[model samples]
Target: MTSKFDHTVYTLRRARLASQLGAQGVAIIPTAPEQQRNRDSNFLYRHDSYFYYLTGFTEPNATLIIFADGRTVLFCQPKDVEREIWDGYRLGPESAVQVLGVTNAYSNVLIDTEMPKFLENIPTLWYPFSIHKGLSVQIDNWLTVVQSKVRSGVSAPHRLNDVCSLIDEMRLIKDSHEIELMRTAGRISANAHIRAMQFCSTNIRNKNQIFEYHLDAELLYEFRRCGSEFPAYSSIVASGSNACVLHYRADKASINDGELVLIDAGCEYSSYAGDITRTFPANGRFSRAQRALYDVVLESQYAAVSSTRSGALFTDPHNAALRVLCKGLLDLGILKADKCGSVDDVIANKDYFPFYMHRTSHWLGMDVHDCGAYSEPNSLAQNSAPSPRVLRTGMVLTIEPGLYIRPSADVPVEYHNMGIRIEDDALVGDSACELLTRDVPVDPIEIENLMN
Candidate 1:
């Protein structure tokens, strides 16, 4: 399929990377290899994020080589009529130059013979480290080939640098194109959540047995129906106490009428990821206990959302959410003041860890976790202690605040076995953050209305 962004976007990205590399560096980026499922079938192919960021090529067994002089060479599969008949169409090397706006293209079969030439005379080699398996060995082999020509004065790169360090920083700041894609992705995911919620309430009212997989199916169906290529990550469809397990996947367990279901799911649109989490009653209306806990989580999420803005510290949202959560937990008797002290004390002592463990936010983009440094890189250069990264315009993150209360004797009975999380994608702006996933209502009344 054709790329959503104009090919010029990718061409500009390559030019920027080449400018960063200057005259002494050569960077190699290879798309992800297809993994075997069992015998002959392979898992669905997904390209490497870095490679796709630069080239927008989705084919497997492809590699991108970029030089410091703004030139790029792509090694991709050659067209074979027989293979095309069996598997699918191949862009083939010849058409890639014109179609992808790369400097040159060649069949991937020539990589072993051509890589050494690309590395010769370059003082530094840049590639992602520890991400691609066996990539280091491959780079070493190519460098060794260049090393064998020492008598001819051909020098291999002596320094190895992680190209991700540069690209990660670039990816952190969303361009206009990326921002629009993420917004659309968020809307798609939000609609999926709405679909799952409506499906669950309708089935439960009809007296049909509901399983976690049932809701999971609705999410997947809606994602694809809305033109998403894949779910951003594994769909989480936890019901009742199962929600307490942070990474719980949808299982075969039956969802009871009175219990709450937590769905943490999203969709991948044009290489961008949108993540959203919602907790709602399996029945049409929430019980008093469920609503109470849900309100606390929702308030905490609002605090986190308010803390997200340009010029604020990245940790501000977490700190803001913690304050709200601690207070709510104390007020609800989940934590006794005599034991955990005041809300401030609970936060300082981390007494709330048992209830709310994870951070309130995370970067979201091409990958769910995305590629970006959490701490400011320039903070160390200022000769001071390391500091949290400052939020900036064009930065996108997820404000996800959750409370997972397992059964505990010290906690109130009504609060036990409850897990509630409120998450929405936020884009950092000059003075405030814009929530991108509000299409799915977080308000209890609104959710009930939608379900009905």
Candidate 2:
């Protein structure tokens, strides 16, 4: 099968990776292994992000080897007509060379026999040991074969390194292609939210009778219609008190007419993810207390997004949003002034955590919470790694601020069992951040109007 990718680009990536590895370094990466979903049934195959980053190959059971001399070698399954009739066509080695622009290709059956030769003479080996299970034993056995040959004057690689460290830096900053795919994903997700709102808005179905799965079904339908690989995460269709559960998956509850429904969901497009959360009234109009609480969460989200621009520290947005939420909770009397102290003291003591529990943002990309270290490199001499700082252009993240008010004595009765969260995906740019999910309406009135 031919790839849609510009094979030259992947070749260039391999070249860059090889140059970074130096002349004696060799790296081996593998696509994700196929997993059984049930008896005699397999889950959909997805290429490993790190492997696909280099090769763009989707077929399972493939391994990539990059040598320090800028050589990219692939070992993959060969074409089998019988297997293709059931599982799908395999990108045989010959086509991989032509389609993926690799230096060489061989059948996966030859890996055990041929990889020992490729491992010969290399000093540093780069592979993610913790990521792929059973990979360590495979490497150990392969090295044992190489170790036996030391008398022949060929030494196996002696040093080990995590490939993620090298690839994480590259993936942290979104390239033009990645950003475009994310943008498309955001569009599809935004529309799904709108469709959910419309489904709830239609008076033909009473809000009290609408099940959480009804809205979730709408999202699933929209996601597939728009060509998503899958949902970035399990869709959270939490209704009323269920909204306070955070990662709620049970979608059996009926949406009450006066209660708020929180839907936190996103779709993965082209292996990239778009995450968004929208909280709206089940009946399409917020009551007085709900309106006040929703505004506070929305304001906190805005504060967080404001700090998401380029050059801001990675922690800046979280801090900025926390301040807004703490103040909001204090003013609303959800947190007592005497007990919680001043807003500064409240933050210092983490008094705000009870109401607003989670951090405001996380890096978003190929994975929902994408790879990339939060901390910058530590100085070898001082050896202290400080908090992560500096958001550069091309970094994408989510700004989500939420307030969950479960029933409590101090919590106001009007707000009991209310949970509100607003989130959006933002891309750091030269001057500001672009709101990828901007198409989704956040204003209470707008949501009400759309629902009406």
The best candidate in terms of TM-score: 1
Error of 1 at 256 (Å): 1.1
Candidate 2 lDDT, 334-369, residue by residue in tens: 988988888899999998887888888889998899
- The C-alpha TM-scores of every prediction are 0.98, 0.97
Worst 10 residues of 1 by lDDT: 1-10
Show the lowest summed lDDT stretch of 10 residues, model 2: 377-386
- TM for candidate 2 is 0.97
Report lDDT (Cα) of residue 113, candidate 2. 92
Clash totals for all models, in order?
0, 0
Question: How well does candidate 2 score on lDDT at residue 276?
Answer: 91
Candidate 2 Cα errors over 4 Å, as ranges: 1-3, 203-208, 379-382
CA lDDT, candidate 2, residue 191: 94
Q: Give the CA lDDT, 0 to 100, for residue 431 in model 1.
A: 94
